[model samples]
Target: MFSSVVAVCIACFLAYIFNQRSREQAGDKNGKPIPGPPSLPILGNLCDIPKSHSWFRFKEWTDHYGPIVRFKIGASEHVIIAEEKIANDLLRERGSHYSSRVFLPMAAEYLSGNMRPLFMPYNDLWRTSRKLMHRLTMPSMANSYQPAQSIESARLLHDLLQDPRNYERWLQRYSGGLIFRIVYGKRVQTGEENYLQRAIKVVHNVERIASPGSYLVDVLPFLRYVPYPLAPFKQEGMRLHSEELDLFRSLLDDARKELETPDVLKRPSFAQTFLEEQEAIGLTFDQGAYVLGSLFEAGTGTTAAAMMSFLLTMTLHPQWQEFLWAELDAVVGDRMPDFEDIPRLPRVRAVIKEVLRWRPVTAGGAPHTLTKDDEYNGFKFAAGTTFHPVQWAIHLDPVLYPDPDQFDPSRWLDPSFPTYKRPLDKFPTLQNFSAFGFGRRICPGMNIAERSLYILTARIAWACKISKAKDSQGVIIDVPSYDYTSGFNVMPKNFAFNLSPRSKLHEQVVEERYRYANNLIYLKPKL
Candidate 1:
């Protein structure tokens, strides 16, 4: 009887909070509603929003409502900036008010304990974390990481040669292994470890709960008031929180142990670096652990996803793959491509650029939270409005990219293209425009990601020929359409492909390179 009474009280409190927020959302300070689909009285388009592949729906909204579109889900207002210029003006020029992350109760508070820098609100904690990340990834320091990245790329090639059937697994292992070394000061030899599987699980769980409308507690903040027994979501959040803490803390302890040996300190890992200067940073041990672990979390999945998409694209568009191969043969020869070769092979660089634009790993960039009331043109935005810079819409803009759906590396090569720039090294200039992001909140890992992708993709093309698999009848199977896995970080769906060494000579070259790289172990610094 007591429990029933408490439930009733909680329900009433939630309804009241919802009603108040609804009242606030019903009004527009400019006296005109922002352009959006028709919303119902109380629900405010709650039923209209899809839980997955929301970027596609957002692009459709842009088609009808112009570049800047606004919609309400429940009592919250969401603004999606499709125009590149507007995104620059708001998210870049006025970054002070727009750089904060949207409040995600389940993700930031319950699950991550607000340790993940990307999900953190703009505050002292975020500032400290960002500073550490920036120092790690800044351009001047990016080159130091190449040795580690090169070694891992060699290992990846060796893995692929031995087990081409599990190409996807090898790719994930490569990405995770690179980060494990960078952050934790350890190399993932086999990649078939419990840690890798659990890490993937943690990311998926965060995506499921953090995404808008996935959990009622995030949408209806008052739901947090319910008793633990009544709220399964909260229980699940607590469970995830504990699991993540244990995993990250264990990695941190391992790094700490490495620091005790002077030899390990010479090639300082991210965790070791932070620990050596923990006093100056003013972050607790656990905070440092989570910060480094969060970096690993952000880097691994997206890079792997992009590579998978690259393979899928290769299988579907053999002409492009052949073109890349022709360039590789002419420029790189039998040698694996490295950082020095980036400038010499513009076509190879263009292919990587087009791949990122065509199938962005995170289609909708992280939601930008507004800290204060703002006005754009004549439209007035409330203080708490959450903005989503929809990469799908922006990358597919017909005016910027003609026939945007088609994969054409030639567009980047053409001097006439609006977004075209010379010297692929300066491609996607951090500030003005990029697949990485916009403004103060742009991904600090951009430099690292670009470098790593170039090395891995170029070397893969140089060493192998990616094509569609064959059936028993010696007929080529049709490549699957661009169907992707569902979540915030979209990857190509499982597809059949034939990844083969380009030649017996190339296979021998990979083995020799791997043997040489394996013998020279370096402490791969985190960026």
Candidate 2:
């Protein structure tokens, strides 16, 4: 209750300050600034931006005002690209100029010590960090991690068979475990395990703090100067910062110690890899630790959320499940699906693409900043302007995707749509404006994320029957199209669904694969 009051007070205070500031003429008559909602004195549409699910509202604005729309909130200038072509032109074609990140005071500065790679501005440090991460997540190197991904996914299938009710938790664990194990060489068997808990807490702290419009300190940098006694957010930031330092630093130390043990070969961990090239890469201890944390956070939450969306789509649209199952049974038979089977399972790939488009994990996108003044379609865009590649709008564009709201995997299967083709062996192409972001700032973990989704969803389709849950009255529960939790990455709210083994033979195959998968997890450590 007190936090709510504080947040309201902060918003009111910020609004008052915004009211006092004079609005600037953003562009000349010949090439006026992009059209947006009319601004009030200093507030400049600050209050117009919704506190939750702003992506939907931004999409609405684009629908009304056209592809490119501009808005000002306090001192910040924003240009939202709703169309893919414009997003591609600016965010992809002109990525060199738009790759830098906007200043994040509360999220990136105090909480993260300005070290979180996702929030870092484009610079030598960011470049070096990016290179280090590329060594692990690059397509050529990503194949090495497939064995772990496969085993972890198989374990997820086994868990689902045992306890389908907690399917959400199992998916979360799978995503968290795979990334955590890959990064720290520590497994997350359960949600409450020490490694998973610490990693999740660190990520939650940053997400809560970093969300746009969450902290007044982010809007008005001077508030950070307030004394610790009065500034509760600062105090919280300090506590989280201390916790992060202790947790990540200790993990780094442990990895170092483990590598030095007698007869112990170095583990396949980002920490060990980073340590090996630490001097060559010119990164400090803190940089390496934060990189791991960033990878785990990005890889886990988004992947888990997308998987959740997939389950929800299946439950809501069970008619398609039969089609998917038919495809799975014909192509994969009774065995668990693997990366090698991706080519044969075009329907599964189409379903994954549709799910990503229907509910993008990064709906509002990680905000990118303009480094210099630029013009787009006769509109003047000043430097330092924040551009949001609003996925909700882009994916729903009528021209690009007909009947965008409908969960139709057939769109990808159709020959007319060239961009909808299933990724052949390699992961989903990040070249276009499909999810995983765009341009230089596209997800480095795209290879792993796509592969994880494919392997898990394909296995689920092969092994289980997904259908809408029914009540005592034998009536299917109605699921609203957009019933979802609100956040930077929007996801489906908890919903009831029936998931059971497709057949005894399928279950047996799943069991055998689960047992076989153990070899990947146990054997890798020995070597």
Predicted model with the maximum lDDT:
1
For each candidate in the order shown, give its overall lDDT on alpha carbons.
Answer: 0.80, 0.79
Collision count of model 1: 0
lDDT minimum window of 10 residues, candidate 2: 424-433
TM-scores for all candidates: the values are: 0.94, 0.92
lDDT of 1: 0.80
Worst 10 residues of 1 by lDDT: 425-434
Task: Return the top candidate by TM-score.
Answer: 1
Tens-digit per-residue lDDT, 44-125, candidate 2: 6768877777887898899999888888766677888887888888988999999999887777777888898888898988
Clash pairs (backbone) in predicted model 2: 18-42, 18-43
Could you give me the TM-score of model 1 versus the true structure?
Answer: 0.94
